[model samples]
Target: MQKVVLITGGSKGIGKATGQLLSENGFKVYGTSRNPDTISNHPFKLLPLDVTDPNSIARCIDLLKSETSRLDILINNAGAGITGPIEEIPEAEIKKNFETNFFGPVAMIKSVLPLMRENKSGLIINVTSIAGYMGLPFRGVYSASKGALELITEAISMEVKSFGIDVVNFAPGDVATDIAAGRYHSPLKESSAYKATYGKTLELMDTHVDSGKDPMFIANAIYNIITSKSRKVHYKAGEPLQKFSIVLKRLLPDRWYEKMLMNHYKL
Candidate 1:
């Protein structure tokens, strides 16, 4: 039987690329967007899904179940980005970011587990970020939210192992996508203490995204993980240096790592 796969935030970017690749490879691929109708002529089917809303999540799964009868793989790629100094960002914005990045994926996983348990096999890949491995200046909230999801994947992987289900985190470095258009950015106030440094770092962040790896790079990574016989709990995809940064963090002293990051951002 062909495996049924659902990818959240599937209208564009990495989600779209993964869906297209998987569909071409012979899987039944369904991707979800908040307003899927807005997009037409997509390669794979698009379902309506808003991860921030439990009702939307439930509805999307119900729709998928109605047609496919089974969901073998789920890609929790739905996420929102936020950038600002920790002190300047509003409490509500932080919570909203969590709703999309952390709580949303948790809800999706919960909704799918019952069916997966019944079938006695399933795979879940939570799309995380290289930024999640460490706190970065001006992007702390985004890092924290993705970091929380990474740890949750670890916990879920163990809990569901007995049920023949697998959960893993796929953390990617910067990728070229339209994510910046939707990112929540705290306004740069000229009088604010962090105005100059925050402004510079913000530009640098955008530069990385614009020049980052192609989305297909991540899609290929996901494809490999799905086809692999035995998978690890964590996998990362991106530039060698970006992947190496994680290793460097483990090796470098606390203050030394901090200094290195500061210099990278030209702080």
Candidate 2:
């Protein structure tokens, strides 16, 4: 039987590329977007979904169940980006970001587990970020949310292993995507203490994304993970240096690592 795969936020970027690639490789792919009808020329079927809304999630999953009763793979690719000094970011925005980046993925996993468990085998891949492993100056909240998802993936993997459900965290570093445009950026107030530094860091962040690796790179990684029999709990996809930073964090002194990051961000 062809494996049924559902990917959230699949209208563009990494999700789109992964859905397209997997569809080509014989997986029955269903991609979700907030406005599926507005998207055109997508290779796989597009389902309307909004990760931040529980009702939307329920509806999307129900629609999937109606169409394909068995779900072999669930890729929680839907997430939002937020950038601002932690102190300056509004509490509402912070909560909203978590709703999308953190709680959203958790809800997704919970919704799919029963279906996966019933099938006796499934793969759940949460698309996180290399930024999650370390706290970057302006992206603290975003880091925290993704980092939380990373840990959740670890915890849930062990819990579901006995049921033949494999939970994996796939962190990608700075994939070239339109994520920058959608991110909630706290207004850069000229009088705010963090204005000068936050402004520069914002520019740097956008530059990194503009020159980031192709989404196809991450798509290929996901494809490989699906085919592999022996899977690791955590997998990262990115430039060699980006992936190495995670290792360096493990080997470096805390203060030394902080200094390196400060110098890199010119903070």
Off by over 4 Å in 2: none
- Model 2 per-residue lDDT tens digits across residues 129-245: 999999989999999999999999999999999999999999999989999999999999989999889999999999999999899988999999999999999999888999999
* Clashes found in each candidate (C-alpha, N, C closer than 3 A): 0, 0
Cα deviation at 258, candidate 2, in Å, is: 0.4
Per-residue CA lDDT of model 1 for 1-267, tens digit only, reads 999999999999999999999999999999999898889899999999999998988898889888987889999999989999999999999999999999999999999999999899999999999999999999999999999999999999999999999999999999999888799999999999999999999999999999998999999999999999999999999989999999999999999999999999999
Full-model lDDT, candidate 2: 0.95
lDDT accuracy of residue 235 in candidate 1: 98
Report the Cα RMSD per candidate: 0.6, 0.7
| TM values, all candidates | 0.99, 0.99
Q: Which pairs clash (backbone N, Cα, C closer than 3 Å) in model 1?
A: none
